[model samples]
Target: MFLAIRELAHAKIRYALIGLIIVLIASLIFIISGLAKGLSADNASAIQNMKADYILMDTDAELEMTKSFISRTDLDNVLQMDGIEQANSLSVRMMNASVNGSDQNEDVALFVTDGDSMLLPSVRDGSPITQEDEAIVDASLQREGIEIGDRLVFGEESELTVVGFTDSQRYSHTPVVFVDGGGRETINAIAISVDESRADEIRNAVGNSFDMVTKDEALKGIPSYSQEQASLNMMIVFLFVITAFVLAAFFYVITLQKRDQFGVLKALGAKTTYLAQNLVGQVVLISIMCIGIAMGLTLGIAELLPEEMPFLLTADEMVQTSILILIVSIIGAFLSLIQIVKIDPIEAIEGAGK
Candidate 1:
């Protein structure tokens, strides 16, 4: 890598541009990953925030909660099981929300559940939305400048009062608003707290009959969850692959430019294996720098956005994604190693434009 570093230092502009591209590309990978994760979390947060071990959804419905429906009968059968402590129903809907008549309306995901449960978490403002005129909004939504006691229009037609707020219970990429059960009786699904053995039994008995799932599986029930997640993930995977090819191609070109240097080193008794390893090592160094800058940039950008932005970065996921990008970036450079070992000293020195 000494040779590669020396070459990069001497041609800093060219190398820096490549590194910048790598940085931008890696940042994009991470930003999209953050967005994907944020979207997943936003869409699934209500379910994720559930204090339950299991969530039951409509069997005929795919994995999305938006498409699911549960009956009072469905509710009763589960309650009858031993070790199954309790269950609560939820209704989900997407609605248009506007504050103070500004062009600032946003889509809010409606979480229709009894507000009295611990599963709903605590309030950030006003009070728990225990009544029809009362509703608890997520803090992320409240940060949009609407506040406690302010009103938000729901659906294509009218509005509902913002009685209180909570940071918990986000669903399908929108902040959650908890309302009374009467708001939407065709409740979307149910959250169930169960013993491990009971979960298995319930899963086997009623699940096989009515078609239900745990929380994770219920995410697939969202109308757009599976398709959108799969599409975005495919793009991320392809982008990573393209990044690897581009890095390898850049390094391969760099190696060719340094063929005479490699010949000289070889002529001085350096092993081809050592020289190849050095090239791979250089790629690793550049990849690390690139990934680091990408993360810094993501943090910087997230801060610059308005508070209303749905962008969120989970610490563990961000760390995991960064490592994965670096690993792939290094793999990209390793592909260049093949070119490093193929250089012929005699041919390179003979100057057939080697």
Candidate 2:
């Protein structure tokens, strides 16, 4: 550790340049990861936040809630099935709504469920819908100057009064408006809560007409959700690979330049293990410092971003990324150890003298 610190102080500019590269790469990874998380929430927070364990969709609907429809009889049958704890109708629709008769309209996702259904999201402000035509909207709609008590006109004659606001309730990148289904004869899907032990029995009882899937599976059924996540995840994987290669190349070159120094130390009784420790220590220190700076920088950038932009950086993700980067850096540093271990002290010393 002492040797590592001494060398870093001696070659401050060289190490600083390496640190800068790491900082830039790490910061970019963090920012992109934040965007990925934000997009996921923007795309399916509504479904993801559901208290239900499984969703029952019409098998013919191809897992898409928009295309699925279940008659009230089917819902009742499933509700009465053995091992079924709770079940509620879920209807999803995409429509344009004008606030308080405004000429302009905004796209919104309408989620129709029973007034007292478990599928109903608890509101952050105001009250949940208790009657037909009353609704609770996602808080994001507040950005468009919408507030509690504002009337949302759905079409030529249909209108709804916004009675409350819920947080983080979005679908397909649009804000959600939850309204009472008022015992509608048909529903888009069924959200159910059941124990894992009883899942298979429930599925069998419900029959082959409906497909039962977990919440995550249902999120994938959302339009473009799977593709978007796949693309972002690929980018993150590539960034990690790039970081590994960059660190390996940088440390390898630095190791080559320090051959004579390493030879002198070895001749003076420094063991390979001692020198290897110094190398690992330097890499770990540098990685930690750079990653810490990158995290702070990324957070600052997130603050400057527009509210409309999807960018969420969670502490868990930050920690996981940092740990992965650190491990990669250590592995990269090990690549340089091969050169150190192979250095012939006599040859290196003679060459330096010549």
Candidate 3:
């Protein structure tokens, strides 16, 4: 450790450049990971927030809620199944809503279920919807100039009064508008709270026409959710691979520069393990310092972002990714260690035969 520190102090400029590269790569990983998580939450938070453990959809629809259509009879069959506690028919449709007097029409995802259903958002600021044409909307609408008691026209004849707002209840990247009054015809998917032990039995009882899937599984059926996540996750993978290669190359060059020093140390009674430790310790120390700086910068960037732009970095995500960075850095440092071990003390003392 002392030798590693002394070497770093002696070659401050060289190590500083390496540290800068590590910092840039680490920051890219953090930012890209946060965006991946943020986009996922934006696409699925509404379903993720629900208490229901399973979604019952038409089997023919292949787990997609929008493509699935369950009738009143299909819901009844599931309700009668063993271990089922609660079930509610949910309908979602995209519609254009104009603020009472303005020509500006916003596209909103309309959610309709039974008035007394648990699927309804418990109001955060105002009263719950108790009648037809009365609705609760995601809080994001507040940013769009929507206010409580604002009447929104759904169509020429259909209009709704905004009765309440729910916190962050977005679906498929769109703000959700929860309403009442659509009967069996509007039933698209059924949300169910089921006993885990009897989950298989429940699915069997629902028959061949319906499929029951977990909440996360249901989200993958959303058109944009899977594709967006895959592309972003692939970007993160590439960034990690690039970091490994860059660190390996940088450390290899540094090792070459110190070949003579390592040879002298070995001739002076230094063990191969000791030289390896010093080399790896430098890599670890540099990685920690760079990663720490990257974290602080990432938080500052997050604070400056507008709420509409999703960039969520959770504690678990940071911790897990940081561990990965350390591991990959250590792997890269091994390249230097191998060269150190291969050094011949005789040849090193003889000055490379020159």
TM-score of each: 0.82, 0.97, 0.95
Model 3 over residues 128-193: C-alpha lDDT tens digits?
998988999999899998999998897789899999998868888888999985465648899999
TM-score of 3: 0.95
The candidate that wins on lDDT is 2
Model 1 residue 319 CA deviation in Å: 2.6
lDDT of each: 0.75, 0.92, 0.87
**Which lDDT tens digits does candidate 1 get at residues 254-321?**
87888788877777888988887777677777888888888899999888967655577877877888
Query: Candidate 2 — which residues are off by over 4 angstroms?
Result: none
Can you rank all candidates by lDDT, best first?
A: 2, 3, 1
Clashing pairs in 2: none
Q: What would the C-alpha RMSD of candidate 1 be, to one decimal place?
A: 3.8
